[model samples]
Target: MKQKVIVQLVDTLDLGGTERMSVNLANTFQEQGWESHLVVSRQSGGLQNYLNPEVQVHFLEKKSFKDLKAFWRLSKLTRKIKPDYIHAHSTSIYWAVLLKMLVGSFKLIWHDHFGLSDQLEENKRSEMVILSKWIDRFIVVNHKLLDYWQKLLPYRKNSIVYLSNFPYLKLNESIQKLPQFTFLNLANYRPQKDQLTLIESCKILDNEGFDFRVLLVGQQVDSNWETQIKQKISEYSLQEKVRVNGPSEDVTSLLAEVHVGVLSSESEGLPVSLLEYGLAKLPVICTDVGNCAEVLKSGELGQLVKVKDPKLLAEAMKHSINNYEEEVGKAQQLNQYVLEEYGALKFFESYQKLVGAVK
Candidate 1:
């Protein structure tokens, strides 16, 4: 049997959920005895370090939306690689569509990591519809997205699939003890991430004399947003209670020190952070957004609160900490469920079957 060749395409290797998934898929493909290559249409960032050394990495260094040089370079590379399939993550589908037009033989699969769900604008939907004809398959992260796209392109229902994002960490249990009751929010500084709401919740915890700290970890995607978060921390006198740490590659080590994991995003497409939290076996407290409720089994496995409500978030956080033993036991059960349902082995197996059926 011939080994399948796959090229995973993405805008960059930034510390975002989509970027991490692209890297994870590429690595998994290589590990599963496939010819795996990763191409970054734009420049690379910190997440590049996490990529498997066996997978080839290419950077086009795209300077603008219409950089003909970058386009030519990607086209040339695609021609040389001659992959059996080009798996495009997020907006990289635009470039993959162009490459398909130029090359004409390899399959093009678009992995939709669109965070807005049903809130997508008219122009974006129109653009996606126009491009849907060229795509051979559409891989969605959740059923909601699958349903939305299925209804949008009724004729293309057979081509769309719902593939959950799997946990990609290799954890080593640490014997070291954590200093304080710590909660981690593992998302980049963005408006949609709603870290400000997390800060407000921290203020509430502090006012009630809770001895805990919340750590915000990820790249500062927006400098203005980071400044606003800092201002809120200062205004609320939460300098000690809240800490904003930039992106770190050592997530497993960080996970070992935290007591709880939290995601306060306003929107999501089945957040990878939630999976990481499960993998780390930390009790999760997340806002009711995206597929979070589904991932938490409607709060049976974790705690879910209303978005933008600091009081509710604080109350949930307090409840989780107060019932740490019981909550952690439930989190441990969730960890096993995640490993069974979204493990790397299962993800790779599904992709193999999907790609086999593409032709």
Candidate 2:
């Protein structure tokens, strides 16, 4: 049989778990001998640098979903590639929905990479509910999302499934070294990330004379959110302890020096950062939301704290420090678990089987 061609569609090549997952799957499939292609609906960003050279990239530079010119452009590309499946991630599903209508050849696989699965009702997209019926299949990054989408598209219950977000291993070491016990957060500045809670935790740690340092590493997506986080950092005089910065290509190397990995997001859907932390063998302190408790295996692998609770987060941070050796042991356990459970090969095999059965 001929090699199957798979195409991944996403809104951007930005630094987020969803975008990283798109790139991850594309790279994995291509490395596994499939003709994998990646399609970016709008502008491309730094994450594009991580893609495998074997994979082809197409940029639509779409102004809006209604941009007919871009739609036609994508339609033409679809005819040329005639892919067996178009796996669209997050917002890119909108375009995929349109493509399915226009071309009517490829299977539409819409992956729900929504972060606010904890608050799905409040943030429901009417357009998605209306258009979801067009999706040939659905993939969710977390179990909560699988539940949400199943309820929304009850007719497609059998078609929806949950898959874990695999890690994007950072191989190179960071150029600069942080303090021995510095905390690292690999998330973009978004409201859902709730960087404020982390700032408050930093303040609590500082006031309690805990002597800690936090390195915020990820893309600066929301200028407003960035301003708010930095304003809080400045107002609290946390300039010394909390270092809010932008994306770094050196995360794998940076993991070498950081004492722990942390996420304070009010909502998340199996963040890839946590998987990277586990793969890097770093102790974790994350807010209990989405599949985090499941990913960390209910504190068996890493520590899980209540969401939006700075005091509790601060306490967890303190505990990690006070029992550094124990946390390290847990980190080692997490490393083995991530390797066994969230390896890229497993994801590729699962997706290959799914695609093979789709027809």
Candidate 3:
């Protein structure tokens, strides 16, 4: 019988990048003859149908994010499943280690999707110092965090793997032109994503008589922040220029019809939206934060400006529109590079190596 691997996450149905990547990785394992299953803390997100039909999903319906009872339940489930490996994505690492210690069978592997500095809250850094020792392997999404881990946690240098999230959608040969007035930002409305910057930039464009439209995708993690942004848009009389479209599974198709892709995040691991934009052949303008600068090859593929600089962002957008041919060339080059580097085959190989090393 094939060895079993259990992938654990806080939610299986959230349309966020990490959640989607977890589903993709779990599905890939099953294709390679491993018995793969997903254990979600809750079932409220919209991602259940996205899992492979063959793979099973278990929901704990934890009472809350801080429910200690859920951790006990997870520990029991881990013992019952007796998986050959336990791959924990995102915040589940906190419990994955303890569960493995309790069950004493599964090997623990943790994937870190955020930047090193953002790993824990400022007040909880002391706690992170304590927990870092329990992780068997640390899968990082970029070189910056890989370097940070190597310098501060030298003993773990050998266990740090640099693999990025893979693109989930494939492109069509019949390329379609984007609508004349549409631009897009695909990220949750949170402080980390810096939607205020995008809103300010759109206001600048509006004042300059640019006839452009904006689509803000992803869930609003902060309702107050969303309301603030809406008020700003109204104050600037930009209702015709901007619309918050909530979360979307149709982002790939939407990107195919958008003139430009924008990411104004204050930080990121490796944005899956940027990869999707490349696959859709849409030009991009993003902030020089997290691994975004590295992914764009230090501004070779797309325009990268400082975060929260509305004027600079607006200027970059104008430059992209005015120099259409150059922007298209950059898009083509980035599309080629992203496909070659982050294809699903490569992702599968990385996981295979991780599992094989432990075996």
Candidate 4:
């Protein structure tokens, strides 16, 4: 009888996987006949274009980490909406925690979309542990994250859940490849993504007379890391072989044009791009990290390589193109997995149940 309201909080609307997931969740909530509100603490970016117009968007333009004025505005908005759950994504957990402390209402759910699964201890932060007490529910994108946090916070272990990410795109039954055999790595420019290694692999392909182009596309998070990527590209003479660009609002068209999808990340947690690749039915070759092996079904669905190994990555890329038809079959199989396991409807339903059980 009553409409449900939810506010998805994010530090920014950057084109990263976590930010995309935040927008996707908000849109899904609105489409499912719920009052969805997306609150951006700092600023909004290209990802905002992907959001449904009906979903309410709020911006704080937060200036610093400890900007009390921004938090004060956020507190006002939270009181106005009185969201059933303030689903905070990534570092925005701090904002949600502060909101609960300030207003003392609404269910607080923290979606831990941490990318690094290999070295959990190194990634741990004191601030996160201090704020964990306020979290009503903890949702992890991968099992590794779930396990790590559960052990660290054993008291709330039962409340932590392992929920895979669901992409915004639907499965494409009829897939198309570009005439030029292009490769697309749809990840933000960061040290964790290891785009430099992908560039090195492209150099190897170019040296071996492979007529292919690689597109490095995502939001430029770290300018210094991006500088390293460009320097590596120039160092390896892959100027024409690789094209670097920022986030694209039209990823569906890009997916349709790319023959192969790749991820060279050293760490990830059910990468949204990998799910999109399956939806697009593009053969994948990614470094074996995080839940990638789970997504690929232990290399049955696509190719997997060790982290940061350019030679292995290069060999896998060569094998993929050389065995194009076979790889495409694997791509189709992966599509089935993604559609069945990572549908937005299923994600929304799960969250609905989880929200009710929150402490």
In order, candidate lDDTs are 0.89, 0.87, 0.77, 0.89
- In candidate 1, stretches whose alpha carbon ends up further than 4 angstroms from where it belongs are 121-124
TM-score for all predictions?
0.97, 0.95, 0.90, 0.96
- Residue-by-residue lDDT tens digits, candidate 2, 3-110: 889888989888878888988888888988889999898889878889899999999889987899998989999999999899998888877887898898998898
Q: Would you list the rank order by lDDT, best first?
A: 4, 1, 2, 3
Which of the two candidates, 2 or 4, achieves a greater TM-score against the reference? 4
Model 4 C-alpha lDDT per residue in residues 196-264, reported as the tens digit of each score: 899988988998999999999998889999999999888988888899998997888888889899999
Best by TM-score: 1
Lowest lDDT block of 10, candidate 3: 116-125
Runs of candidate 3 exceeding 4 Å displacement: 1-4, 65-69, 115-124, 171-178
lDDT tens digits, residue span 267-309, model 1: 8889999999999999999988888888899999999999899
Candidate 1 root-mean-square deviation in Å? 1.3
The true-versus-predicted C-alpha distance at residue 258 of model 2, in Å, is: 1.3
Candidate 4 Cα misplacement greater than 4 A, ranges: 170-176
Which stretch of 10 consecutive residues in model 1 shows the poorest summed lDDT? 117-126
Of 1 and 3, the candidate ranking higher by lDDT: 1
